[model samples]
Target chain A: MMVSLRTKSSFLKIYSWLPILALYISVLNEFDLNYLNLEYFSFNFPFILIFFFTLKDFKHFDYFLVFIAGLFNDTVVGLPLGISSLSYLLICIAAAYIRNITIRPNPVKDWFYFLFIISLINSLNYTVLTLFFSFDLILMSYLVNVFFTFTFYIIFVSIFKYYMRGLND
Target chain B: MASSRDDFIIAIRSAFLKKSTKQKFSLLTLLSISIFVIVLSSLDLKVIKYLKVGINEIVYRSSFIVSIPENLIKNAFIQTTEYTTFFNRYKRNIIELENLKSNYVSNEIIQFENKELKELINNYALSSDKILAKIIVDHDSPFLKSIIINKGSKDKIKIGTNIYDQSYLVGRVIEVNYKTSRVLLLSDLNSNVPVTIAPQNIQAIVTGSGSDYGQIKYIQSGLSDALVDDSIVYTSGTGAIFKSGVPIGKLQSFIGGSINEYKVEFYSDFTQLKYVFAEVITKTEIIKPEEKVAENNDETNNPLNVKLKILEDELKIIEETNRKFQEENEILKNEINDLNFKVSNLNNQISSQKKTINQFDIDNQELDFLKLNLKHGHKCRRTFLNTDGFIVGTLEYKSCVLSKGANDG
Candidate 1:
């Protein structure tokens, strides 16, 4: 039952990917469940992956995963795509530092923090990206999507917990 | 040998951790490649255009493979929408029949008239090349109030085609893709039409300003005979975009006073355009001036000057007709007013005479009653006096036997 690399659960590995793949397909098909629309503020699905990677270990390799995931999300659904990679990497580093003091991987604590951190990072990214272009900021839609995604994370985490019943301590 | 074992252990741990240094390097390299792709997609609209063109080229090259599947999907969507629509209509018809069954006991005549009117309107819709297009979606956002029509460029629809329904003109086509077209309604900020008044024969341009109604401008002054209902507005065909004599709408009412330009309240119910048509006929001809100067004033003076002679005759006839109609309308209005006044005065006189006759009848009744009372009193007195005389005579007879000397005196 202990968290060890040797006896890593296959279910974790399989379920770990389902969210990222779902996000990718959803972006490609413009299929949003209306539960959580992180699209407006540009805190896309890959940011969730980056958050998980950062919390697993704050190594240089984790930073690289975060950047790659960010880059992929940016390419899939973003106006200026590379900006997301940079912003996401910066947020992941900051998140790792914050994780040292807090209950790092606790779903309730980590998900809410990730919501705020990702939103802030996206807002900064949007501001920097649209600095020259006269783009109108839709604050209400952005906030709605943020809240929806956070709620979805709560629900999805519960579902994940049920599915990982055998892995529970 | 120990260092090599340690290296192998490190590789295994990194692989398990999903963070081998080699994997990390590959991740960074992939991120750079993705960044490049993002930059390429964003900075250039040409990229999208090229991508579209590339897809189109592939589609064209492999049209035998592509078009069948594409058409099948399109047909499926169309057929499904049609089937659903038919089912809805069938349900509605059943409900209507049920209502008719219940209401037939009382309002059969009214229902029959309604049926007749619906038949007429359906006939009108069928008379032309009108397409019954369903409005799939209206851009609910205020910033974009365009409507998506069921028929699009794929249906041979083109831009600038005017849209209408049984009620009235709705809008014109602005943008057209293969399977989708955007219709900008009459209430959009950028819509205009040239309308002519049938009664006054005055022409004006109507402009839309995203309001409920459009504005009519540039009408001539002093057209006083133009009533709220008199204006029969139709397409002038001056713009050459819309055909002539298509019944756009009747003039509901006029807005501004005569000094400034006036806006007409069009009778066209634009909000409901479930079916409409774009007139395909071109009704306007371009006028050339070179043909005019050749038959100028010098030619007009000649006996066979067709232009002046026709103009003079038209002027004379128009003046006479105008004057005659003006006088007739004035006379009719005056007569109407006089009849109303006379009717009121006659009513007043009849009421007064009736009041006087009632007073006289009351006075005559009082006089007759006085005469009857006097007559009755006189008759009673007379009768009493006669009786008293009779009694006195009888007593005198008795007394006379006793005193004949007193009776002789």
Candidate 2:
């Protein structure tokens, strides 16, 4: 009985680290389903995952790990080494600021805050990639990405809440 | 108001500098490091380049391994769709194969002739061997159309080396690591290919439309009117960036009010690419016999002798061209002689035909006279019963036979 309990706790510990694992997997796999043939159909899954976990102040979500994931994303997507890192770090900062300011956390408020943060971050990404790095990026693609990321945030947040509930149990 | 402002400042500072127990670095430090890295990357430092190559080599391999499940799913989806349209696609492919088979010989001949011409103009021949490469990462990013391949500088892949899907131009290598490279696809907004629109032969530049298609730019103002839909668009080899005559796409014209737009429908689908060929080119310089002799005599270092050798090569080329022209002239002269002989044979046939027609006419006249004699000859007969009849075998008798016995009068 004691061994089974220990195994159960071990499984819970692993389960608690699911968000970071998902971030790494998303970056490596480039979770965009391009086979759908939808034009401008990409969403920043890592951004949503990072924002939600950072806002919740999840214990296992390490800042250094997130930064490394950003670098991996840049390598995979052929972007400059630090471009994604900058964007991801900015997202974490925004989520942290929001978490610090809120006295009572509300899901609706958080959802709207995610929209504003993603829009600003995506705009900054576009500006940096275009003006600083001289990368030719379509403004429409960035806008579409922002839209999809914002829309999918609530859905992923609910699923994450379930995971958190299971971890609490 | 002062308390609220203080609270705002405290919250901001905490977000920037505060680190929780699980977090090692403050968000502000990471932010600063990120910005610094971005600046360094943009500066193109050599150390950063090697560091990036090391990071790319590791990350690309890991990404490829991690991507296996997703790639399998993608392949399954594609295979499902392919199977659904299997029969129709097979039918279409069969017809296309036959048409391509008919054109293959002519295309080879043209390719050989073009190679010879290019070698003649430039003193070196470019021999290219295409090495097949597997795509390691194909994320199909919304903002950037690029892919990572498994072949890189280790395989002699240089930046700007042309990548192809079969004979169709796909993209070019933009970044090369030790064993991996990134290809900036032609669908990227930054990619520009110098192309010739065929049938009209208008030269233009094709820039990516940030979509699957490309937009035609830098063309003459009124030449757009001459561009027909489905006209071939191929690289023109201008600026020596790409080899000439590599097929890119076909022209698609769209018309709006007071506007004409032309797009290129790429021959190879960038999304469907699984493996690509990277062309590794080697150039070999052509030396003339005179230049070889000069080299053997150890006078190759003399500039005057080099110039004379070049002039001699030019003279040899001119003489060769003249010889070809003379040979063509001789062939044309033989063709003209053959045509003249045929004309003489036809004239002889015509004269013999005319003689036969004259004989036929004479026979017809005699037959007519015999028929007339059967009916009206009794009145003009030169028998003893008639007083003014001529002798039977005389010229007058022959005249009488011809003129219906008018001489009997």
Best-fitting candidate, measured by DockQ? Answer: 2
Clashing pairs in 1: none
Candidate 1 matches the true fold with a TM-score of 0.38
Interface RMSD of each: 11.4, 0.9
- Give the poorly placed runs of model 2, Cα more than 4 Å off: B293-409
- Report lDDT (Cα) of residue B348, candidate 1: 100
lDDT against the true structure, each candidate: 0.52, 0.88
lDDT of 2 at B132: 98
- Candidate 1: Cα lDDT at A3: 55
Show pairs that collide, candidate 2. none
- Residue B2 displacement in candidate 2 (angstroms): 0.5
DockQ each: 0.09, 0.67
Q: What is the lDDT of residue B136 in candidate 1?
A: 45
Candidate No. with top lDDT = 2
